[model samples]
Target: MITAPLPLDEDLRLRSLKRLEILDSEPEEAFDRIARLAAWAFKVPIVLVSLVDEDRQWFKARHGLATCETPRSVSFCAHAVFSKRMLVVEDALDDERFLDNPLVLGAPHIRFYAGAPLLLADGQVAGTLCLIDTVPRSFDPHDAEVLAGYAQLVERELEVRSQLIRLQTAHERDRRSLAISEARFTTVFKETPVGNALVDLDGRFLDVNQAFCAIVGYSEDTLRTLTFAKVTHPDDLAEDLALVAELLAGKHTAYAMEKRYMRPDGTAIWVSLAVTLVRDAAGVPLHLIAAVQDIDSRKKSEKALRNYHVELEERVRERTAELRRSRDALQTITDNLPALIAVVDRDLRYRFNNEAFRRVFGTPSVALRGASIQDTLSPEVFESLQPLFARALAGERVTCNEVRYRADEERVWCTTYIPAEREGKVTGFYVMSHDVTEQRRTEQRLREKALIDPLTGLANRRALQEELGAILTHVGAVALFFIDLDGFKGINDRFGHDTGDALLREVARRLAATVRAGDMVSRLGGDEFVVVSRGVADAPGAERIAQALCHALARPFVAGGTIVEASASVGVVLRGTGDAARSVRMHDTLALADAAMYEAKRAGRNTWRLARHTAADKVKLNETRYPAEKAKSNAKKHSEF
Candidate 1:
């Protein structure tokens, strides 16, 4: 027997596969369900989602197989990966390459085989979605097409899982970065040379750093209980209070002045005081950041040289230099932050903005200041955000998500509006926006993948449950048809699973086509299907639907170039006359319909049974048959088969 040859890019391909970090991972339901559906579709006893490693082909998801992996030398999937396409072996025993392969000769005893290579986004073949059987069978082009479709589903699942892993990794990295940033801020605040303190709106000190405690000649604990007003000299108190009132009134964000502080000994020392109001995202004042620098020596020197113009000029230069240094430090911090932040006054003009705000809007800081919001933003974007801005101006905190285009690429931004209040009146608002495009896309992918049946492109059982619950809660009357395919097992046994899967897909299509536009049709796994019909007024209307479904299934289907016949055994349950439907549980209705389906099978195949709810809330079954002419036509078609 010949072993599969390695591709020219074997090392690169293996590296790409290992990068997914899925080689030896635990089984995921997302993958396992795909395997199960492929098994049911192909009517194969063994199906696997195989990932080819350096020395082995490992099964990430396996159905009808116990072993987790096999040596690459004996793996059929390895050959499929090497070929980078669908590989079909009608009879492994007759094929010279696999005739002596251990998997072909021993346990599992593979004869017929089909493998579809799984390709990643970068065009690297990781492994294969393979079907194995113990007996020889032919695989047609249609069979190959079905296998390819299932393979694509496996690829999508891999992409989604990989994307989730990457996203999680990014989240962890961001968390670490955030923790580091907070630590740096704490260090900077505590170790700065200037005296810094956090004061509340009521003039009470919330926190004071070491420099502040030294300047005030008070312990940090002793200062916490005292208000800034208590430490200020009485002569300077009125002016300081007026400046604070103006700060809170949103007339300015910050103010600076030479002020005198009274120490415990009643001695007054001059200080250069800078106060900035800190507001939350909602534009409400949270606290005040005060930086005080002891300037007693400078004040004394200024008094001694009051008549000297040169001395006065020198002092002015020194003070200006210190203020520039403080402004530069604050600017450095704001520019490093990733989020876009800006302050807008009540007239919708920009008052202040961070570096990120300028970068995102492509405007310089000088251009952005005092610019109207409407002029700074595109007409479309301004129109969309006008109401949110108005809401903030009206003292309402608002948050919304928006889709915007920049550099011809679409992005999602989460923006929050915080109203700044001055004496109970709104004076301005703060805007903070973050990009969330990737996050939104990931959530959307997860949602879509969860609700759809990858094999048939129909809604799965979960979607059916949700739809059923919604219908029962709102609709007056509804009918549920539980359909089980008749004589399906015989077709699978005769024509192989490939043919059986094709037939199942055809059945799903026919079932969908037989229902009304608003009717819901879903596959409940294997050969079972369900159709939900809303606004069915009576049993006759429900019966007509069931009959139509049975007749649709009764028609002969050509799968894998062979004529095959199958019929439907439908069990129907009709619920509600009006609001009474809300009282019926989804599970109870489904259970009754399932039981009635069994009764239809027991009565005879190719017919339907109606399950009616009695006054006692128990179910009573009534058998129904097709019209005589339709029954005769079905019989004649079966006879031809």
Candidate 2:
């Protein structure tokens, strides 16, 4: 009964085989181990974990065959996948499908055969778990059932392998997601460049980065043992700790403040501190994140600027004192002065003009006042004056000496310029004018004065009292000191007045330049001078200035072709706000200051005496000398003010 071969649905069969997802996989011991035992159990010559393909049966493991794949036209298992029921041939010569199949007749001659369909998970035929024997045999239903049970076991293993592949894929996805999240966390924590810390619930540091470690000046290991409180400066401790406690108690999620952090060496640094409490899923506090930014440098700059402002104020006070002196002298020497006095703005516009200006310009000083200089001066003068205005407006103080006017009949000499100031940007100017013609005439009359001393303008005495007063007001927070030149008479006699006068003038100028604004130097008489420094910083301040003066005057003073030198004894008296004990009274204080000066002279010729004000200062200063009670009732004045 040779007939045409059965036409297999090749595509569906291949898809069914692939759904197993087991093609070309390594021989798994779970399935292969089953094949080995089955080969032995059935006492068969061949056994296979075969996956059916479109036109072939491929073996995952073959017990009795060396070939891995066989052509389906000759394959015995191919027919099995097309049928769900087990196929058995009691004798191959009797079955048409197997009667001429080459595998049944070839090298591994299969005269008897039994194969059961391998069921898929989707309920379709996948392949077969089959056994083959060389000789024809009779079949029993029970034996067919028993071999079918082995096939089911192989199917179970295939299912498990599929499950493992899915589980492995899921695990990889989860791992990738976690890695991305951790990388983001690392980026956020490390790059901010501020001091940041992660601390446990008990406020112990778990981790901190390099910036935080540098700020606190502690190693990671050392900081781990200490809580945040240990690094807080004492002045800021109470407030910072209170915020910490509040956050821990759930009063707030975050707290921030400007604080000071103490370094390992116990120095404090200023920082703006911000802390946030991190919580767990249950809303219970778990850790704290602290961020600290150092502000010490910025704070120092501000303090330096403040100090600069104070120094600037002292300079203004000195200039104000000079102006007040000139104002006072105007009352004393009004008749002998030259020309007019006026104050103008940066534009050379008048602020005020004196009575002399009204007579000289002929126009009402008020009418010409607040008008530009171009109104009265020529174009050349106006152009020259522009640069002067620009300098003054730029905060420079300018002085013009001996300005000759083409408009005047006589060649005139005067000093005129503006005072410079500072604002946020632009500097405003204040104009001051002085007439020197009469003063120059007076100076010409005193030929003897010029010969005596350059500073004092005294015939015999050097310039003294005025320069002493000038120095006193310049250096604030100082003590006034007096000094006496000792053992000077003999030197003058031996050297002649020419050298003596030179020595005196040298001493005067040296002393004036050395001391701060608080101290003053005066020539009371020949070989005697007093030093006064008010608002002295300390006794040391006065002592240092005095020592400097002594060294300066000790240097050679050359006069009239002769070289000579002299030394002075010094006396000191303390004054001003920082002196808590009001020890010195006004008149009596000057007397004491004077007496101390004399005592230094008496002690020898070159020593200094510092007035002791502590005991008496506590007694006499019990009452406030200033801010006196007035006739107006205190309540009424308070209301008015």
Q: Estimate each model's TM-score.
A: 0.45, 0.37
Off by over 4 Å in 1: 173-180, 249-251, 263-270, 279-286, 296-641
Pairs of residues clashing in candidate 1: 42-497, 282-418, 282-419
Superposed model 2: Cα runs more than 4 Å off: 1-43, 53-58, 66-74, 82-102, 124-126, 137-146, 164-184, 191-195, 201-203, 214-222, 260-272, 278-285, 292-641
Clash number for each model: 3, 23
lDDT (Cα, tens digit) per residue for candidate 2, span 1-641: 23223336556656655755788777777777888898898888888877776666789878887888887667777666655678787788778877777776777878888887777676666677888788888879888998899989987877777677778888998997767455434433443345668888776888886668988899989999998878878888899878888988867766779998899788888887767665544556667777676776446334333333233323322323342344432322222223455556655677655555555556665676687777866777677667777777666667665554455555455555555444554434654445456656655665545433344543322333344344333433446665666556677678888777777777776776665432345666665555654434456556666666666666776755776656766766666543343433444555555556555555665667676555535412213221233334323322321
Candidate 1 at 627: error in angstroms?
99
